[model samples]
Target: MTTMTDTSPREFKMPDVGEGLTEAEILKWYVQPGDTVTDGQVVCEVETAKAAVELPIPYDGVVRALHFPEGTTVDVGTSIIAVDVASGAAPAPASEAASASASAEKAAPATPAAPAAKPAPAAKKIEGRKPVLVGYGVAESSTKRRPRKGVPATAAPAEDTLYAAAAIQAVQGELNGHGHAPGGQRPLAKPPVRKLAKDLGVDLATITPSGPDGVITREDVHAAVAPPKAPEPVVEAPSAPAAPAVAPAPVASYDGARETRIPVKGVRKATAAAMVGSAFTAPHVTEFVTVDVTRTMKLVEELKQDRELAGLRVNPLLLIAKALLVAIKRHPDINASWDEAAQEIVVKHYVNLGIAAATPRGLIVPNIKDAHAKTLPQLAESLGELVSTAKEGRTSPAAMQGGTVTITNVGVFGIDTGTPILNPGESAILAVGSIKLQPWVHKGKVKARQVTTLALSFDHRLVDGELGSKVLADVAAILEQPKRLITWA
Candidate 1:
């Protein structure tokens, strides 16, 4: 191993892959300490609330340390890894080294006095440039410090060492109820920890920090919020010899043998929140119709043999999606969202068609942009790419936003029908049931034909019963008569 004498490590902060996302959980790390990395080499994969994204190192260097382990959710803009950019560089002059040692000793005293230490400095501003992922230009938010009494508007870089020392001392003072003076330095903690403390009404100044570098953690906040245990009763000794004390039962038992606990994070956590919000906020009205889609099924087979769509995916869903798009065109008011704040209804002229896909991580609804503009062949190609990318867990965050309507195909799993909920910010969702051969009257004769059930759920706040029914009836009519796709278009 080569030793560097005076080189400083470069810190690579976690980038916000999804705009406005506050934190991401690290899924895996590709490189470790002492591993050499080059520019644009992926070092880790992280999952934000929206999707999983791979982060690459911006410059070539040897990794010095990883700040957090896998599964830890870190705030955006926090340094996750440090790299020795100038490894094997020449040592500093003796005079410079001596001066550096003196400065270090002065800045970080053996016993820190919180009253004398200064606040840590704000991040340096790079004029005309914003913080970004390695290649993608992403927005970087300014660091948010907890509200303190007497912190200065700004601080110098030289105060960083003193701040660290003061933070360590503050942790000890927290136990003694003398953490920060009325106008002294603030306690050290991560953004999430601070938020948790705020939410639980716990004071950070009173909790002892257990994290490295004297930083407060989520567990510290929780411990502070919990009530202190009652002191055990002190029983008087009996005249006779005391009997053997019974061992207490285990306080908690791990049922690893019968049940496994999986942490809900990343995509799954976001999906749960969204689902709950959508369910409670929207008054959903569902309309169902069972249609004989024999002609649509026949057309799907015929499209599979067409030379123009030779490489594309042609399935019943493709036709059903087309029918829905046509139905929206006929009843444009159904393609709308209720703006609660504005007290208005937003009717969209364009269509962003979302398809609910189930992945190993969780269920995700990625949509096609401008679906109304795409032809049949183009739509098929887009659907093919969407399914392939979702299965590989590489769907981008942009592909999942701005959806005006959604389709959930429960038929794939042999479900007959389901009342689907609207995606948040969307007005309608169509659920397709399994298509099977059933006895039907064709030209006054009973015959076996392909039939399926379609259920359309809409936000009743803006979509009245009549409007919802018209859209559902239109979709069923088009599916039953496959030629309506061309006629309606």
Candidate 2:
């Protein structure tokens, strides 16, 4: 109920927690209004399209207000919390009496074009600071927030007006087309909306965005698809007799006893969109191979006993991953991405090997950087860390980007194998089946051997049958002859 006139408060805007992520759902608040917080203390956890991230308050202060409650999906750069750091100085007794008697308009502060800029002294504090989020766009700490010209000092501050201001500016820009910021960037729209516009053959630059902040929306896209027509013919039909009313069907409640509807959002929604885009956009061709990996299994066990890798993870997945990397090295052309815009096949020189990990929230594929260059021990360490981080739901968005190839170990769930859709922007995905003891001829005699099935799916536009087969065959060959890892690698 108290308003501070002595100091301007600081606002913690929602950071772009991932690459180009537009919005995030606030899941929980660790600190409420009136709670004291120190620098780097986590204040909230938000679920973005990629993952849930805990945002740490960057300075010491007492929280003035929580702008939005939990579960609000707020756009990035919007102030979500307000904090005051006037060295613990309480509001003056006279100011308190005035605040009590003051009208709402008199207490309301002027809205800054941006955040209440952080003081310049904290610059060195974050100078060497590495990003806590992997691949997330961190909001820059500002040294100044230019107040709109002619606003009086006595005017109160608007702590929660980030989205609203952007919207007003965006609308103005839309009305006056070609209104670009100092640095001319295109209008704002979600990736899917852009994709939809592309699919519908609609030009986004030509359309006037009706969404908040002049962002293009799906409805706007569909509207663009429909042909414009002159006002509908005004026909006054003779009054007709009303028909007898019929009984209507009762709609089922989402919260019914047996049925529950979960809102499509966060990682699952992103995964779905990516899957759909991959499936329809790219011509997917899946190939399968059943192999006896008894030797590979034995090698895995042997690696576990080795002194160097004693504490690291040693499993079929480790060997499978190594085998795939070796295969990619042999058939380098198979490791590529199809760039639709450039109309070129981008063959990557290095491998960002993605390991698809299933978590409580959703499935995430975090990759190991320069995996092709890693030795067996180094690869094992990275793989172990990737799995642990993914399972704990702490995997960074950066770890999932720029993957040239991916591996989904569906065998862990006891499934034989699956034709996994390619991860968006990647050429292929390999699915590993369950390693089981099955009857097979290993030395020209029927005997029990560790057998498994692998499914490789590739973008048909880039990978021809011969090339895809070579990659799959090489992976199988390495697993069939585990010693080949030494010879081939």
**Backbone clash count, each prediction separately:** 0, 4
What is the C-alpha lDDT profile of model 1 across 67-87, one tens digit per residue? 999889999889999988653
List pairs with backbone clashes in candidate 2: 108-156, 109-156, 109-157, 110-156
lDDT of each: 0.72, 0.72
Give the TM-score of each candidate.
Answer: 0.64, 0.64
Error of 1 at 99 (Å): 22
User: How large an RMSD does model 1 have?
Assistant: 18.0
Tens-digit lDDT track for model 2 on 1-489? 554354778777887767788999886676788988665445775777776655666556799999999878899989999988655332122233234334443555444322223233344443533333223222353212343334323222232332223222221121111112233334445434544665577766667789886666778889978876632332223352233133346666753567766888898888899899889999999999999999898888888999989789988889999999999999898889988899999999999999998876788888999999998889999999999877645566777888889999999889998989999989999999999999998778999999999999999999999999999999999999999998998
